[model samples]
Target: MSDQNVAARTRAALDAGEGILRLAPTWVPRSFLMPGARLKLSREDLYALGTHRGGIDERWFSSTTPAANEGAPPDEGLSYVVHDGAKFTLRDAVGAHADELIGPALNAKYKRWPVYSKFFDNLGPIPHHMHQSQEQAEKIGLEGKPESYYFPPQLNWTGNNFPYTFMGLEPGTTKEQVRRCLEDWNKGDNGILDLSKAYRLKPGTGWLVPPDVLHAPGSLVTYEPQWGSDVFGMYQSLVEGRRVPWELLVKDVPKEYHQDLDYLVEQLDWEQNVDPEFKANHYLEPIVRTGSEQEGFVDKWIVYGTVAGKQVFSACELTVLPGRSVTIKDPGAYGLVVVQGSGHIGKLDVDSPNFIRFGEVTKDEVFVTHKRAGEGVTFKNTGSEPFVSLRYFGPDAHSDLPKVGDYLKVG
Candidate 1:
C-alpha cells in the first residue's frame, strides 16, 4: 500500500475504536524466513502462548537485609527478628525460575542489560522533587549551576507525588527513545517534570509505572522495579541557578510516541490528599486488593494501606516495639526499608556488623533483604521508641490468584 493509503486506513481504524496494529510471535528462528518478512498475530494468541510457553518467572522484592547477629554480650536495648510474616527472596522465589515467568523472546531482550534493584528512600518529612535547590541536589549527587550548558535541576516530591521511572523491555524505536531519555535525565541537571501533573501516594502504597508514562511518587517513601533501562523526558526545570528553555526541551520530545502525554496529564488527581483518615501529617491512602486468584501466583493492591493476596509483588508496613521482632516464613527475595525510628534485623548481637540499624531513615539509604525458600528472617526495634519498616516481595510470593476489583482505576 502507498503511504497515503496507509495513513487513511490508520485514521479510519482509529476513529472506529479499532486499528490494524500487528502483534508478533514471542519466538522466531532467525534463519527460518527471508529478511524483512512480517508475521502478524493477535493479542489473544500472544497471551495464550505466553501462558503456556516456558518462560522465566521473573520477580522482584525490596527491603532491608538484616545483619547476622553472632552471640555477643546481649545489649540491654538490642533488637531482633521475629517469625510471624511471609519471608522470601527474589533470587529463590523468582530469579531461579525467571524462565517460567518471562518467555524466551522477552528474556532475550532483557539479556542485553544487567538487572539491579531500585529503592528510593524519603527519610525526611518530605519526599524528593525533580526540581529543587542545588543544596538538595548536591546531597543526592546531582549538583551543577543552571546555565545554557545544561538542563535545570528537577525536584521530585515523593511525599505528595507518585514519581515513576520506566524500562523499555521490548524492541521498538519508541522503547529505545524512552530508554535514552531516562539516561540523559539521570546524567544532566534538568530532569523530566510535569508541573500540570502530580500524584498523591499514601504512605506505603506503590504501583507499577509502565513505559511511556509521566509519573512520580508523591511525598512518602517508594520502591520501583522496571526492565532495567533508563529513558525519560523532562517537562520542567525550576531549580535555582539552572534553567532550560521550554522550546529547546520540547524539541527533543519524542513526538511520535508522545501522543499520550495529554491523556496522562488529564489523569492527574490533584484534589486528593495523602492523609484522609488520621491527624498524622504523613500522607496515607487506602490500597485496594486485586488479582489474588491467578494460577501459580498471588497479587494484591496496596497503593495505600494493607491489602494482601498473591501476585508478582507484595509489600507491607510494620511497627516494631522495643525488643519485639517479626518473622517472615516465605524465604524469598524481599525488601525491608526503614521509614522511621530505629530497628535491627537477623541476629541483634551488638558486635555483628551485618546487624541492621536505623538512626533516621533517609532517602539516601534504604534496606533490602534476600532470603531463600523455607528460610526466615527477623526484625527487632532496639530504639527507645517504636520502629517502622516497609517490606516488599516479588510476584507470586504469597498467592497465585486474581482479585475482582483489583484493577488500577486511576492513572
Candidate 2:
C-alpha cells in the first residue's frame, strides 16, 4: 500500500482500537549494516538491562524472614528492590537512533518503543505484608489480628501466588502442589479452581497472559514481554511466611471485578508439567491484534521463533533462511538480542554489527531501529547456520486475546 494509505489505515485502527502492534525486528534490509558491525549482549548485560533499579541488595535477602508468623515488621530495606515490570521502557533508548535509521521497519520499531520520559505512569516498590486472624494473633503472642502474609498474584490482579525462584522451580516441589494450589484458588466463584485442564505451553512456546487472569508461568526462565505497567495485587507471601488477610486485600478490588474473581480463577490450567523438556524451548502463541491495516501495523504474536509478526525476540536453535528475513510493518518501537549466530538489521548505511554474545538476549545493548510508513526492516543471518535471537516492541502491542492458539505457532 502507498505510504499515505498505510498511515491513514493505521490512524483509523488506532482510533477504533483494532490495529495489531508488531513487536519483533527479525528482518532488516541488507543495505543497513555498517562495515564490520555486529551488536551483542552478555549475561551480565542482560541482567543489567532488565534490572531497572539496580542489582538485588543482599541485606534485604538476609534480613527478611521467610516464615509467615515471624511477627517481623515490614523491612524498609526491602523497598529498594524494584521489579523489572515497571522499570524498563521504549523511550529510554531512542536517541541511539536519532537519525532516520532506515525506512519503514525503522519507523514501526520506533512507534512501539517511543522515547517518552516515563514508560509507565505508576511505578513503585512492592510492599511486603501479612494476613492475620484473631486466633493466630494470639498464638504468635500478638495483641489483636494474627498477621498472615499472602502471596502476590503472578502479574494480573488475581489472587494466587505461584512460588518461583530465579532460574527454575524450587527444589523438592511436586507438580501436584503447583496444580492443586492454582486450582484451589480458582474456585470459579471468586475462589480458585483446577486449571490443569486448560491449554499448557510447550517447549519453544510462548503465551500471553491477559490482565486480571489468575495465571502463573510456573518457576521457569522466561523472557516476559508485557505492557508498560507493574501494578499488581498479592494473595500470599512466602517471603513473609504468612497469608495476607483476604478482607484487606479484597477491599482494594472493585466489587464487580471481585464478584467474578471466582469465575476467572476457574479458568486456570492445573495439569501442567514440570520437566525441562516442557519448559526449555520457545513457545509461540497468538495474542489480540490492535491498530489498522493502513496504519501499517497489524497483528501481534506471543513469539518464540523467527517471526513475531515481523519482529524477532529469541531465536535459540532457530533458523532464518539466508537472504531472507522477517519484515516488521508495525509502527511501534522494537529491540533485538542475538542469542546465537550473527546478523545485520535495518538500512545498510546506519546498520551496526552486534558485538556482545550470550546464550540469551537482553534489552541492554540492543540495536534500536526507527522506520517510517511504507518502510520496514529485516534481519540477515550472515553465519553459515541458522541465526538465533530475541526481540521486543513497545507497549502498543499489548492485547487481550486469550490462549496462545490465537497467535501463530512456529516449531
Candidate 3:
C-alpha cells in the first residue's frame, strides 16, 4: 500500500470510531507449546491453522510487532483496525500518523508504536528460556522483550496441567551448574529444572519479567503486556521428552557466536537469577487507583513499575457495577480487552463473548488513542453484573504509575 493511502485510511478510521479504533483479534501460535484452550477460541479451531502452524494459543492486541515464528506470514503479529468493513494494519497507521495514534513525543523518539500486549495459554509448561536483552538482540537485528504477566480471574478459572512456573535459578545455584546443563543438552533431561524453584500460580496477580531472565511459564493462562519484540532463546534442551534443537538456543545469536558457550552462558542475568528476594521484587497484585464503590466503579493497576528505570509499559483492571457508570481518563494510547461482563465504552458497543470462532469480529477489543484518553471516555455497566476490562499502555504511557512496592500499601 502507498504511504498516502495508509495515512488517508488511518484518518478515516479515527474519524469513523471517534478516535477509538475497533481492533480485530490477532492470533499467534507456538509450535513447541500445547494450547490450554482457555482463550475462548473454539476447540475444533484451536489448531484450525493445522498442527503444523501449532494451536492458536495466543491472542495479541493492538500489536504492530511481527511474530518471529518460523513459518509466520508477513502480517502475522500485527493488529488490524476495522472501519466501515475495511481494515488496515495498525503498523501502517502508526507509520502514517504516529503523532495522532500515540503521541508526538513518543513518535519522535521511538519512530513507531514500540509496545504490544497479548494473552498466552499453554496446557503444561514451556522450557526455561530468556528473551535477549536489547544489547544482545541488536546483533540479531531485533529489539529486546520486557514483559509483564497478569492472570485474569475470568480466563484462569481452570488451570490445566501444571499451574506452577519455574523462575530463575536457586539463590545458591552456580553458573558452572547451568553451563554444565547446557553442555549436557543432548543427554535426555538437562536437569536444569532441578536447579530452579516453582512458584504456585495465582489468578488476579502478575509479575514483571525483564530481559535475560530465565523462566519456564506454567499452565496458567497469562495476559502479557510487553514491549514490541519477539526475540528469545530457549535454554532448556529437553521439554517433556521433546528434543529442543540446539539451533533454537542460538536462534538469536550472531552466526559466529552460535557455538560460543561462554557467550550463551553470559546471556542469563546472573545477579537477577540469584536474587534471594525474587518474589518481593517481581511479584505484583492489584493496587486500587483512586475512585470508589460510591462512584460505581474502580480501577486497579495490575502491572506497573519500570525495567532498569525505563518506563516500558503498564496495565489496569477496571470494574463497574450494574446500572452504574463513570468517565475514566488515561495519559496515552492503550489497547483494551473486555474480560468479564461488558456494556459500553465511550459510544461503542462492548460485550465479552463466552466463545469465539476464528475470524469472528468482536467488540471485545479496542484501541484508545492519546487524545480520546486524555479527554476521558465514559464506561457504563448496562449488564446485570459488574463489567470488567483489562487495558495496557506502551512505554512511558503513565507518568504517575505505581512502583513495585506500592501494592504493599494497597488495602
Candidate 4:
C-alpha cells in the first residue's frame, strides 16, 4: 500500500478506537527455556512454532520493538492493531503518528515508543545473564536494556518449579573470582552459581534490574517492564544439565573479545554487583499512589525506579472490585494486559481467556493513547471478581512516581 494510504488508515483507526487501540496478542518464543504453562497459551500449541523455535512462553504487550530471536520474522515481537480485519504493526502507526499515539513530548524526545513490557513465564530458572550496557551493546548496534520484574499473585496461583532468583554477585565476591569462573568455561558447571545468592521468590513483589546486572530469574509468571532492546550475555555455562554454548556468552561481544575473560567480566557493573545492600537497592513492593484508592478501584505503583538516573519506564497494577467502575488518568501512553476478571475499558470489552491458540486475537490487551490516558478512561468490572490489569509507561510518564530509595520505608 502507499504511504499516504497507510497514514490515513492509521489515523482513522486511532480516531475510531477513541485513542485506545485494540492490539492482537504478540507471542514470543525462547529456545533455551521451559514454558511455565501459565500464560494461558493453549497447552497443545506450546510448540506451535515447532520445538526449534522453542515454546511460546512469553506474551509481549503492546510493543513496537521486535524480538531479537535468531529466526523470527521482521514483525515477531511487534504488536499489531486489529482494525476491521486489516492489521498494521504498532511500530508503523507510531512512526506515522507519534504525536497522536505517545504524545508530542515523548515523541520529540525518543521519536518512537522506546520501551515495552511482557509476561515472561518459565518452568525453571534461567542461567545467570546480564544485558549489555549501552556502550557494550552499541559495539554491535543495539540499545541497552534495563528491566524490572513484578510477580503478580493473581496469575501465579502455583509456582511452577524453582521459585528463587540469583541476582548479582555476593558483596565480597572479587573480580578475580568471576574471571576464574570464565576461565573454567570449558569445564562443567563453571561454578558461577556458587558466587551468587538466590532470594526466595515472593508474589506481589518486584525488583529493579539495571543494565549489566547479572540475574538468574526463577520460575514464576513475571510481568516485566523494560527498555525496548534485547541484548544479553549469559554467564552460566550450564543450566539444568543442558550445555550453554559459548557462542551465547559472547554473542553480543565483538569477535576479537570473544576469548577475553577480562572483557567478559567487564560487562558487569562491579560496584553494583558486589553491593552488600543489593536488596535495599533493588527490591520492590507495591505502594499505593496518592488519591489512587478511589470509590471502586485501587491503583498501586508496581514498578517505579530510575535506570541510570532516568525514569525510563514504570508500571501500575489497577484493581476494580466486582460491579464497580472508576476513571483512571495517567500522564503518558501505556500498554494494558488484563490478568484477572472480565471488564470494560470504556466501551471495549476485555476478558481473561482460559486458553489462547496461536495466531488468535484476544481482547485482553489494549494500548491507551496519551490523549485517552490524560482525559481519563473509565474501567468497569463486569465480572464477579476483581478486575485486574497491568499497564506500563515509558520515559517520565508518571509525575508522582516513587523514587528508588522509597522501598526502604516499606516495613
Candidate 1, residues 1-411: lDDT per residue as tens digits? Answer: 344443444333222312111111012111101111111112223222133321111111221111111222222111111112222222222233333322232234432112222333322211112221233233334321110000001112323222232211222223233334334543444333321234333333434332222333332323443222222233433322234333322332334434454422322222221113211211222233321222211223332222222133345545556556665454334434444456555542111122222221122122222322234545566766555544444433445322322433433
Measured with C-alpha atoms, the lDDT of residue 363 in candidate 4 is: 86
Native-referenced Cα lDDT, model 2:
0.29
Selected candidate, larger TM-score, 1 vs 4: 4
lDDT of 2 by residue, 1-411 (tens): 344444444343222321212121211111101111112223243333123323211111101111121222332221111112221111222222323322344345433222111000011112221222223233334322111011111111221223221222233445455434434443422222121122332334444232232232332223444332212333322222323334433333444544444522322222222224323222344342432334432333434222223222211112354444555444433444334445554432112234334322222223333343225555565555445444444332323323324343333
Q: Against the correct fold, how does model 4 do in TM-score?
A: 0.97
Question: Which regions of candidate 4 fall more than 4 Å away from where they truly are?
Answer: 290-294, 405-411
Model 3 CA lDDT for position 264: 89
The residue ranges of model 1 lying beyond 4 angstroms of the native Cα positions read 1-208, 216-227, 237-313, 348-373, 400-411
Q: Which candidate leads the pack in TM-score?
A: 3
lDDT, each prediction: 0.29, 0.29, 0.90, 0.90
Candidate 3 segments whose C-alpha is farther than 4 A from its true place: none
Question: What is the C-alpha local distance difference test score of candidate 4?
Answer: 0.90
Assess candidate 1 and give its lDDT: 0.29
